[model samples]
Target chain A: MEPIMAIVVGLLYAAAIYMMLRRSIVKLVIGLMLLSNAANLLIFTSAGMSRGAPPLIPLGSALPDGPVADPLPQALILTAIVIAFGVLAFAVVLIHRAYNIIRTDNLDQMKDTDT
Target chain B: MSLEVALPVIIPLLTGTFCVMLWRHNVIQRVLSLVGSIALLASSIWLMVSVLREGHVVMYMGNWVAPYGITLVGDMLSAIMVVLTGMMAVAIAIFSLSSASKSHERFGYYPLMHLLLAGVAGSFLTGDIFNLFVWFEVMLIASFALLILGGERAQMEGAVKYVTLNLLSSAIFLSAIGLLYGITGTLNFADISVKLAAAEHTGMVDVIAVMFMISFGIKAAAFPLFFWLPASYHTGPVAVSALFAGLLTKVGVYALFRVFTLIFNQNPDFTHELLLWVAVGTMLTGVLGAAAQFEFRRILSFHIVSQIGYMILGLALFTPLAIIGGVFYIMHHIIVKTNLFLISGITHRLLGTYDLKRLGGMYKARPFLSILFLIPALSLAGIPPLSGFFAKFIIIKAGIEVEAWFVTFVALLVGLLTLYSMIKIWAEVFWKKLPEGIDPTPLKEGKTSGSLAVLYLPVVLLAACTLVIGLHGQPIYEWAEFSASQLLNPEGYIDAVLGGNRP
Candidate 1:
């Protein structure tokens, strides 16, 4: 399960870099989404996978009876997801603004600031 | 035990909430922000005093113990950083009140300003790596909104690259944190410092260190990764630009200093040595880039990268005096660079442009502003009797002591080139006459002295800071010496964080 997840994370990252390198403005957004998702999955997989055991402790017990999944990674993942979502939402709006103002969907055309 | 440590984050968080609540009343929001900034400044100073009296302040969230719960640790370095953030906040709050346009006020700028401050303070305070990510996002989101608030065409253009590149860096940072946690099985800084030192997988740890370096490097705007900064920083409102210039990259440098000094010290040969070469690249490319720029703000933006290199150079040297120099460099750079940005704003106000070619005759028209500009400019160029002189001198001396002769030579060469760029702006913006048909009258003409005084107040205050830090270098040097020791030895930090949270 760990190896499979790692493969999937690698694919996501590969795709993200590919998408990000494209000149089209929209691909960049897609790339960003993939990149964040890859990072989230990387966290999930790298922490070592467990079966369906929850992070919760048994009632009145200080510790779980069996090997429970690591809860901290999940919490970190949830935080990462929310932050990435907020950033992505803002990025979409910004890309829309760039499109409207720069009058082109090409990232190449956004070079007005470079000169 | 940790109440003061919490105040820096809490004050800004509460104030930001109030700014949001008073969203409809722009003037009131500005007043609230000013009051809140003063409160934050007070709290940060109090935190500094308490840290001086006592040693390392640590707080665990919800009373959870270390290695399991989030921690906030205030060592000497983080304490001083919070103080700097508070000072910049107060200055920027006052500057924005008089300078920010109606549309900016209408668009909830104060709330975002406070939010960014909260994130910056939180970043300085947090003891957990993952928690640092949350704060970084908070800062990034607010800065993103602030950058494109006006939605100018060029802003939209600059913000795109800025947003995308920063998002990528955040992704890299998040992935790095995840990997580190996997190896150490702990998220707490001190806990990881202990565990990773004992861990058998030394090579993997170095890999993660590089990841951290690359991500934080982008945030710090280092060489080859600094393209986003020069493109985007000058597009924002002057208040946003100045605040970002002062606080944002310094936060990145702070993190670098913290982690490299604390958790990543096991392989200084790999990490610190790498930083040494990167620092050289950063200095040369940044100064050369600035020398080529025709725009006033762009040159300043490029110089931010070069100065950042000096700070990292100090860190990379990894000696007692070098670390002291690094700490002092950040302190001096933040105040001086922010002051320079504020001066540029006044220049923009007077001349109605940021283009160097079109700007001229400020020496004749506004001698005071010219004088204001020269202070930070000369300081940045490493002129004597200024903060930059001490900062550069300490680092270069350390570099030579360590026999990093090439780096020392590059440092001196960069200092000379920095002078060239500063003189370029001084010549074009002050000595040369204004282009034909240009009125030298400021855009906001006939303003009462009260409002005009408001405009000059923050710049004057920061200039005073530069002078004070220059002339009275002993106290600040002492503070940096203590902070350098703290970074060089993290046993105390680890002990406090691992000692468990106490009331």
Candidate 2:
């Protein structure tokens, strides 16, 4: 199961990188989103996988510390997700404005104006 | 533990939020920002003196232990940067009061500026990597808003490139943090330092170092990643451009100095060589770019990239004296560069344009403004008995001592070219006769009073600071040496962060 999860993340990362190499502005935005998600998953999986049960113990039950999924990575990933979401939203609006003014979404066409 | 140490960050944050609430009352908002900036400047001075006497001061949040929680560490380097930010903030606030139009003021420009200051100060003072990331976001968001506040077509275009490149850098930064955490299982810088010192994974360490370098290199406008800077920085208002010039790239250089000296000093040979090559490339490219420009602000924008190369050159030399030179260079560049940009603002208002072909004979018109421009321009070109000369001398001496003669020669050449560019502006804009069909009478009549005078005040103050720092170089040199020693000897930082002698 751990190896399978790693393979899945590897594939996602490759796809994200490929998409990031595209020319269109919107696809590049989606590429960044995908890349961020892959990073989050990579961080999550590196802390080790869970097998037995959820880490939360019942109210009066004896706490078992043997093998639980690490909670810290999940918390970090959640924070990163929110922050990346905010950045992506801003990027969307910025790109929209750029397109409206420059009248194109191609990255190469937006050459340095001074030249 | 003193409140003075924290006020540099706190005052800006509080005032920013308060201004948001009082946005309708323009007078109240402006007063709040003015008082806040003044108080920040005072506190930064106090904090600098205290840190100079007491050494490094660490404040752990909520009474938590340093390793387990976040910490704000105030040393000579951070304290000096805070003071610089405070001073720049106050100057920009004063300039904006008279220069900013009603529409811009209505859009909460002052509040955003304060928030930007708060974020810059926080980034300088933070002792944890994650906390630094948070501050980067704060600064970026405020800068984003400030860039687009006018909603002009050119501004929106520039902001797009700025935001995109910065977002990509942030993503890379987060990935580096994740990698570091995955290996060491800790996010605290001091804790990670100790762990990394004990670890034996050389290959992994180099990979992580490169990741950190690339992320920071983009922010510092290093070679290969500096295209976004000249594209975007010229589009902002004069005050915003001035503040950005003074504060933003220095934050990246400061971070590079902190992390390399503290956490990644084990393998200096490889890292220093790579950084040296990058520095040389950055300098040559930046100066040539500056030489190609004809506009006032665009040339200055490219020079920011070139000057950053000098700072990185000092860092890449990896000697104690060299790092101290880097610190001095940072201080000198911040004040002089900001003053030069603000003077450009004055020129724009008086001459009605920034193009060299269109502007001429300003010396006969506004003697005071020409004097203001001359001092900083000469200082930037490394004239003797000025701050820029001393900074270049120290770094060049360090480079030669290390037997990097080729790089030393290249650096000197860059300095000469920089002087040529400066003189081009002087000859074209100030010395030559006025261009045809230009109404010289309006500038002559309107130069001495109103909004223009207010803008000149900040430039004058900054120019005075450049001269003073140049004249009194001994004390600043000593402070920079002490700061560099603190960085080179990472034991103190590690002990303070991990609660003393963890081994």
Candidate 3:
């Protein structure tokens, strides 16, 4: 089950990369959204999949010997998700402003400023 | 107190927040920002002295131990960089007081500037890779705001490319961090070094290293990833351009120096060779690009790329002297490059154009400005008795010592072309006859008050420091050598964080 989840996450990353290569501005934003999700998933999957029990160990209790999911990656991924969300919001507003001013969604048309 | 270690970051953070509140009162914002920048400069100087005297200083947030929490480390490299950033910030702040237009001033420019500075200092002083990424975002967001602060058509157009490329780099950087954390199971840089030392997965480590390099390379404006820089840098106001040119990309270079020397020392052959080629290509392409530009700001923008090659060349050599050379080059370029940009600002205000072909005979009108521009331009061209010459001399010496003949040849050739570009600007903009229909009356009409002179003072002071450091290069050289030694040995950094090796 864990391997299947990893495969699904990998496919999301592939789809994100594909959308990122599109010429339209809207697709680019979607691509960034998908890519960020894929990154979050990558962090989640890399810590090893566990289904046995929660990572919390009660005080005054003997440590469980069974496998437990690593909480560190989850914590890291949560932080990353918040950061990505902030970045995506900023990117979306920036692209919207760009579209409004330049009056075009084509990335190729936006290439006029490159010297 | 050791609390001085955090001043560079804290001052700017507080000032940025303050500026947001004082956004309506332009005068108060300017005055407060000026005071804040001066305070930051003083603190940075104190921190530099403390680091030089006491050696490496590490500050862990909330008393958290290394490998378990975030740490900010201040060594000589970061200390020097912080000082440089402070100096540039203060200079640009002073310049902006009188130069910034009503629109730019009203839109929270002071706050954004300080925010940008805080982000830069944070990125430099951070000891953890993930924290570095966070600071990169901090700086990026501030820059995005500042870039479009004008809302001009050109600015908007430039912001799209600038923000897009930067966002892409940020994404790449995040992926790299995720990969690194997965492999090492620790975000602390010092611990990662120890873990990487014992790891057996050389191939995977190499892949991660490339990811880090590409991400930073894009930010640093290295050859293949530098297209966005020139396009955007010229579109902003002078203060913004000066600060961005002086400090931003160097943060990227600083990160490259930190990561490559500390954790990724496992595979030097592939990484170093690739850097060498990039250095050569960046230098050649940047100079040729400058040669084709007739506008003053555009020419300066291209020079930023060309000068970056020198720093990258030092990294490629991967020796103590070469690294020292890289550090010194960073300091020199920040001061000299920024002075040139500020001088361009002065010229633009006086002449009403940045185009060299449309302007001339400025030497007679503004001799002080001419001198200001000449010193940095000559320094940039690697003339003897200036900081730029010594920077190039050290790198070229290191290259020959290592017997990297091709890189040495490219450095020399780049220096000559740099001189050509400088002389071209001088001949056209200062020596030729002043273009008709342009009033020279601005110089004669305006008051030579101290307030107006205050703007030029920062650049003049920076240029003087460049000359002073060049003539008295020994102390700086020694400091760079000391920092290089610390960087080459990660044990001191690691022990400070993880509290010595665990049994």
- Candidate closer to the true structure by DockQ (higher is better), 2 or 3: 3
lDDT of 3 by residue, A14-60 (tens): 89888878999889889888887877787777656677679777778
Backbone clashes in each candidate structure, one number apiece?
Answer: 0, 0, 0
lDDT of 3 by residue, B32-90 (tens): 89899999999989888888887878887887777777888889899999999889988
Q: Give the candidate number with the greatest lDDT.
A: 1
lDDT (C-alpha, whole model) for all candidates? 0.91, 0.85, 0.87
By lDDT: ranked, best first? 1, 3, 2
Better of 1 and 2 by lDDT: 1
DockQ, all models: 0.86, 0.47, 0.56
Candidate 1 lDDT, A1-115, residue by residue in tens: 8888989999999999999999999999999999999999999988878888888887899978878888888888998999898999999998988898889998877787885
Native-to-model Cα distance after best TM-score fit, residue B192 in candidate 2, in Å = 0.8
Best-to-worst TM-score order: 1, 3, 2
TM-score of chain A of 3: 0.89
TM-score of 1: 0.98
DockQ order, best first, reads 1, 3, 2
lDDT of 2 by residue, B136-244 (tens): 8889888888888777767776787788778778877877887787787777888888899888867988988988898889989999889888988888887888888
Worst 10 residues of 3 chain A by lDDT: A43-52
> lDDT for model 2, on a 0 to 1 scale?
0.85
Model 3 CA lDDT for position B116: 95
Error of 3 at A36 (Å): 2.1
Tell me the spans in candidate 2 whose CA falls farther than 4 Å from its real position.
A1-10, A51-64, A67-69, A112-114
